[model samples]
Target: MAKILVVDDEAHIRELIRLYLVDEGFEVIEKANGEDALAYAENQSVDLAIIDIMMPKLDGWDLCKELRELDEMPILMVTSKGEAQDKIKGFKLGTDDYLVKPFDPVELVLRVKALLKRYRIDASSLIKLGSIMLDRRTYQVIYKDGNQVTIPMKEFELLYKLGSYTNQLFTRDHLIEQIWGMDYEGDERTVDVHIKRLRERFAEFESDFKIVTIRGLGYRLEVYRD
Candidate 1:
């Protein structure tokens, strides 16, 4: 489901938009004004944002500008006023689409869906580490020597990230922040535990297939083919 940020002062408008988007299979996040919208955008991942122009603290143009600086997520500026200057300002601030108020709710939904479809991502479809193969879409981990492991959520993510980058080492502190979010509430030792479990799981294939520890630096996946 696509995550959408709806920034509007009117509670009725927020509810109206949320209802419409949710019906269309979107995950809607509602913010009453520009400041809270900005804060949400900085932390959460949003596929698209619908920003209203006449808002408290920071207006839509300024809010869009701030969001553009932080993330490349597509933005749609909505305003009651359909002035050319307002449209230009939003476009200059890097908004992907725009809608004027008193607009059709269906049109907004269509626009949101179209924007996401047009900007779809084709990220690396697969990640491989040693004899382990990770299928990005299916989220499957298979060993080359015939053993297979089906990982659950975070564990799968941790291994996939390590596999995706191959030989680049990442410290436990770094993995906690990167694989887990920066706001991860877990201890640093969580990385060590997961790595240990992963190593144990892979032991059926080869005792030497590497997730090497660099003493204090941390772990890297390295198995010499020679």
Candidate 2:
């Protein structure tokens, strides 16, 4: 059973989340504030974390920064503040996903599972294609000529999944399920956005492969050999 850490100031909210998480066969660890949550994280092997931003004693943002410094465990931010800036801040602090208040328990569970799946895939292997090398140990990509670029969490996972099986076509729905989770109710175009950003970022470096679209199917990483 995977262990999940839930941090919220409200007892009812914590219990609500716990009920659903436990029903899904996850071990639940609860904390009312970020202070306690941070302590628990340091001493425990938490697979994922759901944090409330408006808590007393070390808010979610601070705790997120602290935990991000320690490990790459997936972090999800839940709060009443649903502004774009808040979500962006959470992402910048290394949060894997953001859910606003009044969220559905089912959606929460889906996100949790999705994050765990993505994390497992990321930690499973190190991938190298031609001059580009993805080193999971350092969470970075290095080129044959020693040029290093640190990819964001989501982008890194996207690259890993695509590059893991070169020339294999992955449909958009499959990628969303594998990378974003089953309950991702967002637009499918989101995948295109991420892929475009990946291409743009890698364009600066020398890489032997490119992520290509399969015309109505999805995308694939095509490696061109010299």
Candidate 3:
């Protein structure tokens, strides 16, 4: 059973979420504040976390950042704020997904399941997208014809991260924080430059996978499957 940590300031809201999650066969740990939730996660094993943004002590934003720094567990942020900027901020903070208040419990469950699946796919060191194989251990890309190419470290890391979760959108800020260190004082265009090189390097492998530019957003890796 997957153990889920649910943090919210409201008692009734926590109970509602817990009831639905428990019914879906998930083991839930409910915390009324972010402080308690962070303490529990430090010592115990938690598969995922559901956080409310308006908590009293340590709001959801800070909690999400702290949790992400600790580990790679998927985080689902719940808040009444449905603004685009709020969502972007949450993504930048490393929250895997977001849900608005008064959301259907069924939709919440589905998002949780999808996030778990996506993370499971990303946890592998070796990701095979069609005939292109990314080996993180060696930082190499292997082609279908048994040809292997070792690219620049940053380019390889960027490619591997995208290929890990095909079709999942990643913001530029989020990518920078993940690939480069959080303290990186470089331009976001650095990601664009690396992405351009990856695209040029793998131009011949378009049939295998393509790094898609999501215009105002960022990017996602689309793998063509037979």
Candidate 4:
């Protein structure tokens, strides 16, 4: 069973999440404050974390930052503030998803399951193409020359998709669906932007592969043979 850490200051809120999560066959670990949650996360193997922003001691934002540094598991932020800035802040802090207060229990469970599914999809945690080593666990890329490059979430997913299948063409719409999701409102140009960013980042190191653009089709990873 997957272990989930539930952090909230209110007893009822914690209990409510526990009931829903437990029903979904997940093992829930409850914490009353961010301090306890952070400590527990440090010492235990947690698959996912459901954090409330208005907790005592360490706030959700700080706690999320700390936990992200410690683990690569998915994190979902729960907050009463529904403002766009607040959600952006949570995303900037490395939260995978966000939930508003008064959310449906069923929706919460579904979101949690989806996150777990996404994280567990990769059979190999580390994928190597040419001289580039992509660590799926931490999303860090290491070059053969010992230089480490950090990639953003979307860019990293795009690179992983292409790198995992060297020389396979991926259409713009296909990449959009795979990385940005089916509900993405952005145009195909979003793929172009991410691809550009990936190319620039890879250029910083002496990489043996390059992301090639296919005219009128999409892109692929081209690896140079030794």
Candidate with best TM-score: 1
lDDT of 4 by residue, 35-135 (tens): 99999999998889999998889999999999989989899999895566788888777799989998898999999989989898323356787777888
Task: State in Å the error of residue 149, model 3.
Answer: 40
Worst 10 residues of 2 by lDDT: 121-130
Q: Write the per-residue lDDT of candidate 3 for residues 1-226, one digit (tens) a residue.
A: 4789999999998999999989987889999999999999999978899999988989888999999988889999998854667788888787888888888999999998898888873332568988888888679988779888899999999988998789999999999999998999999999999999999998987988899999999999999973
Q: Is candidate 1 or candidate 3 better by TM-score?
A: 1
Q: In model 3, what are the clashing residue pairs, if there are any? A: none
lDDT by residue for model 2 (1-226), tens? 5788999999999999999999987889999999999999998878888999898999999999988877778998997944667887887777899898889999999999899998883232358866788876666898778987898978888888898898999999999999999999999998999999999988854348899999999999987752
Q: Which segments of candidate 4 are over 4 A away from where they belong?
A: 121-226
Model 3 scores a C-alpha lDDT of 0.89
Residue-by-residue lDDT tens digits, candidate 1, 147-225: 6557877777777777767688988878888877889897888888888888787776454357778898988877544
Q: Once superposed on the true structure, which residue ranges of model 3 sit more than 4 Å away at CA?
A: 82-84, 121-226
TM-score of 2: 0.53
Arrange candidates by lDDT, highest first: which order? 3, 2, 4, 1
lDDT score for candidate 4 against the true structure: 0.86
Give the least accurate 10-residue stretch of model 1, judged by summed lDDT. 121-130
